[model samples]
Every structure is written in C-alpha cells, then in structure tokens.
Target: MSDSSVSLRPGSTIGILGGGQLGRMLALAGAKLGLKSHIYCPDPQSPAFDVTPFKTVAAYDDEAALRKFAAQVDVVTYEFENVPAATAEILSSLKPLRPGANALAISQDRLAEKGFLASKNIPVAPYRAVHLLEDLKAAVAELGLPAVLKTTRLGYDGKGQRVLRQPGDAEAAFAELKPHPLVLEGFVPFEKEISVVVARGVDGSVRAFDPAENVHRHHILFTSTVPADIAPGIAKHAAMLAKVIVVALDYVGVLGVEFFVLGGERPSLVVNEIAPRVHNSGHWTEAVCLTDQFEQHMRAVAGWPLGDPRRYADVVMQNLIGDEVEVVPGGIDGDTQPHLYGKAEARPGRKMGHINRIVRSE
Candidate 1:
C-alpha cells in the first residue's frame, strides 16, 4: 500500500493508460525532461500516438498485452479517471501507478466522489444516489427541481448527464439516462466556475497553481483564464483545501479540483468535481509558467521534487473544439501559442486542439 519508495531516473519510461490529448501532453512533457512515455489505448486513432513512438494499441482488458506493456515502463499513470479497476490492479502489480488506484476509483463515480468529498468535510453540492424512477422523484422532492442527473460512472465532457428543470422531467430523464445507479444533485446557481490544479509528490510535498476562471460553451470548456479575478483570500483558501484533499488521498501526480463560486458578496466555493490527472483548465500554465501542469505531474509521479507553480503572466487558453480548429491563426497576433492534438478528423463537439493567448502583458 505504500508507494513512497517509487522514483524514476531521467531515462525511465512512463506507461500512460489513456491516449487522449492529456496523454499526448504528458508524453511531450516527459520528453522535455529526458524521459520517455509509452501510451496504451484501444483507439488506433488516438492523438497521443503521434507524439511518442512507444505506444501499444490494446484494449484495457487485454491482460496479456497489458503485462507486456507494463514490463517496458518504469512507472504507470493514467491520462483519464475512467481506467478500469481491474486494469489498475494488473498494472499496479507490475509497476507503481501514480495517484494510485483509490484516487481513480473515487473519481470514476460521481456519487462516490461526492460522498468522499463530503466525508472529508469538503464542501460540495448536495446530492443523493438514484437507482430508480421513485428515487429520482424522491430526490427531486427533497432537493428541488433544476437538478442534475448523472451516471455514477463512464461520463465526461457533458456526455452522460441531463438537467431536470421541472417535476415532470423525472421519468423521461431517468429512462433516457440508462444504466441505473445514478446520482441526483441539487443545482447551486453559481456565479463562476474555477479550478485549481495541484501536484502532490511521492514524499508528501504539494504545490498548487493559481486557480483559473473557466468558461464553458454548450457544456464543453471554452476558455480558461488564469489569475482568476476573485478575492485573494478565496483563492488561497481554494489552494489550501486542494492540498488537504491530495494529502488525504495520499495522491501523487497532478489532480484537478474544480469549484463553483456560489453567489454572494464574497463568493463561497462548492466543489464541482475532481479530475485525477492533468486537467484541461490548467492548459494556460504552459503559456505563462516555468513549470507547467504536465511537467509538474511527471515530476510528482517520478518521485522527484515539485517545481514552483508561480505564474509569470496572465493567459487565456481557448479550446479549438470541432469546427473551431478549421481556422488557425498564423501568428499575426503574437499573443497566441497554438497547440494542435494531431487528430485526423474534425467532428461536432470533438476537441481538436487549443491556443493559449497571453491576455495580460507583465
């Protein structure tokens, strides 16, 4: 159960469990530090494959292939939280899985994640577990309407969730949201969404970047502006709570903690959700910080000292979702830094790439 002794040298290979854009960024960060990455995913068109030669196109449940992949890497980490428990167990038996299986398990379920946060005395939206139509009605009655119904597992980017605006929306919403074992959450009319990306080292040291103000369009993250325009004390409090949460989990690598700044004169925060890896909200760090979130994650997972997360400038990171990628700025406006995910296709709601534009000159 103890992962304190796990550390990697410069030439060590990191085994990544998902081949999304996050994995691609992790691989690129590892390379910058004289390290290597091996991406394993079932998708042949995984964008991460373009960044590293060390890759395995195998299903998560393929135990035989998993073992082969594990043997080649020094340590294991995942790009996403949905990595199966069985797969985590198999890999942890062979190598050190950073942020550990417990963290993954908790974050994978919306109900469990909220429960865990509440147990830790972390402020979160009021929620109830829903497995039946009656349960949904009871939750709606108890928590009121305009709530969110989400699957306990296997959901992301607004994929497996629906809002219940009225009392009558229960039966249809429940039936539509197949796969029982869901969670009903009370909606907090939040003023703004913010997120803190914190890295916890193998030896218990923690470093958190400044929380970023996030904006979403049609349920997809549209932009993240760093050095969020919020009360200084509130920002500091967010960072402190984030570090405490990581310590409680005995977590290593980067963990993203999103929050809803509730309506008030001085905003009070309610935890929205947690992502167990480097998050999209922290992408602005690459444009304004010396030690970005990706590198901080690699540092933590490798049992190395954490880098300072101080920002040098304020930046806004805009995601190029779907058709947004079609127009690429040719640096005529020198404020932007373009990063394409190398995905071959551009479909609706698909994340193709991003551009980090420095908003404040400092």
Candidate 2:
C-alpha cells in the first residue's frame, strides 16, 4: 500500500476498473474535484468511456495494457467487486489500488464473506457450503426448506440464485444450477431490506451514511428510500456494522453493506451481502447529500480525508430499468433529478438510468 501521507492532489488521475454505470458516475464526480479518471474495460461501447477523458479498451488479463494504464494514474479503484485477483495484484504493484485486493477477494465468494463476517461476530444468515449432490441434500436438511442456494462467485442481480421451497426441490434446483461451488442460506423472515454506504479513508477513519431502506422487484433493486422508516438505534447499529467491516478489511474507498431488517419487539439487522465498491443502493446520496457517495469514494481512494455522509433531506432513488428509461425525460417532476447512463441499448433487466426525488428534511 502507498503511504497515506502521499495523497493524490486535485490534478491527479484515478484509474477505475470496470466501465459500467458506477464507473461513469465516479468519473463525473472526479471531474468535479478536478481529478481525471481513466477507465479500463473490455467493452468498446462502455458508457463510462463517454465521460472519462482517458480509457483503455482491453480485457482484464491484458497485463501489458494494465501496466501501461497503471503507469498513467496516481491511484486505482474499481466500480465492481468481481475484479479479478490478478488484475488487482498487477495494478497494486504499479499504483495504489485503494480498498485493496482483499476486499474484492472476500466479497467475490459467498462462503468466504460469510465466514469473515461471522468471525468478526457480525450477524449473517445461516449458511452452509455445498460442493456435490449429497452436500446439497445435507445443506438442505440443515438449513431446512425455503432456503436459498447461490453460487459462491460472480453472481449478481438475481442470477446464480435458486430458492428451494420444498425438500424435493433441492436436487432439481441443484441440477438446474449446476453450481460447482454453492452456498445454502436459511431464509431470513425479515420484514424489510436496508443498506448502508460507508467510506473508509486511508487513515483508517470510517464515515457511514444513514441506512437506506431498499425495495426489490424481480430480485432487482426497485427503489431506495433514505431516512428509512426504522428506529434510530437500529439505523445506528447498521452503520456501525458497515464501519466494522471497513475497518476489518483495512479498506480505503466506499463499500455498500446490505442488511435484512427483522421487525419484531426488538428490531435487529442481519447482513445479506457486502459490495466492495460504490453500490446501486447509494444513488440517493447523489441528490440528498452534500458529498455524494461517488465523490466520497474518489476522495478516499485519493488518500483524502473522509467526507460527511449525513443527509440533510429525505430522498428516494428509483431506477429506470429497460423501457422505463424512455419515459424519465418527460415523466419526472421538477423535484426529481434524472441520471441516465449513456448506454445505447436498453435491454430487458438493464439499468439505463435513475431518478432521485427529495421528499423532505429529517
């Protein structure tokens, strides 16, 4: 790791891995801070390239291109968690990869992440690893029916997941999935879902934004509402949990931690997953907070002090998925701010844009 004292000033360049919407937003935020962004992605039509001045269209394993890209940037960060370990290693050897490879490594595998969290005494859903048909059957027996069977790696947006609602469903589900490395999680009968977006500075200081209550449609994030209708104590606990994770990873940059809110006489939170980069759930921070999550991530990766994450107003972020993007330009009111990712084709289940509406102050 580079010395924290060796901060990248405003004119420095940040190299971002993965040229998706998250990268696009980060590039826009960096530009506001007078920091240039160089995007690296295999896709020639990556939307992030539209905003960044410097871009390298190459595969993640292109070491020659990776080295060349690293030499030009002062620091490195990623927009997604699935960044290959080798890619992160090569980049960190040349330029500082803030949040480090460990963060990505842990978050990439479901088993490892759950183990790490459990070791840290952080609550998570009951899970068991599965490798074969017998293992799947045993895991089903232990976790019970109505459990989730998910692949250990590279799964997102409802992919690589199967719900086993009955004992007989396990084998068929496993057959359908053919997941070599899998994890079975006992379902959490939670009333709500929430996420905390937290930033950890190079100095190990952590700052977390308030929890945002999340709503999902077809297993994809539908909306995120800030000033989530939860007890203040429970919100604080969730933020604290995120801070614990950041500190444990020795992370520098922003991370999103998703939680299941169990509503009862005693409100509690259980971690669902850890996103090792700027998250979809945090888009509301763009319109509601003075220092948005994107800028906060840029600041942290550049070795700057952590920014204030407190929101002064209540806001709701609604994603414009697929055809919904077409109506955003005309359907939104004056209070709503529309952000469109410069994606050319709006395929089904693709996130094309989002609109944030400030509802009121806390």
Reference-based lDDT, each prediction: 0.91, 0.91
Candidate 1: 10-residue stretch with minimal lDDT: 326-335
lDDT of 1 at 261: 90
Pairs clashing within candidate 2: none
Candidate 1 residue lDDT tens string, 159-191:
889999999888888988868898999989899
lDDT of 2 by residue, 311-361 (tens): 878889999999999976687776889999999999999999999998853
Clashes by residue pair, model 1: none
User: What clash count goes with each model?
Assistant: 0, 0
| Model 2 clashes, total count | 0
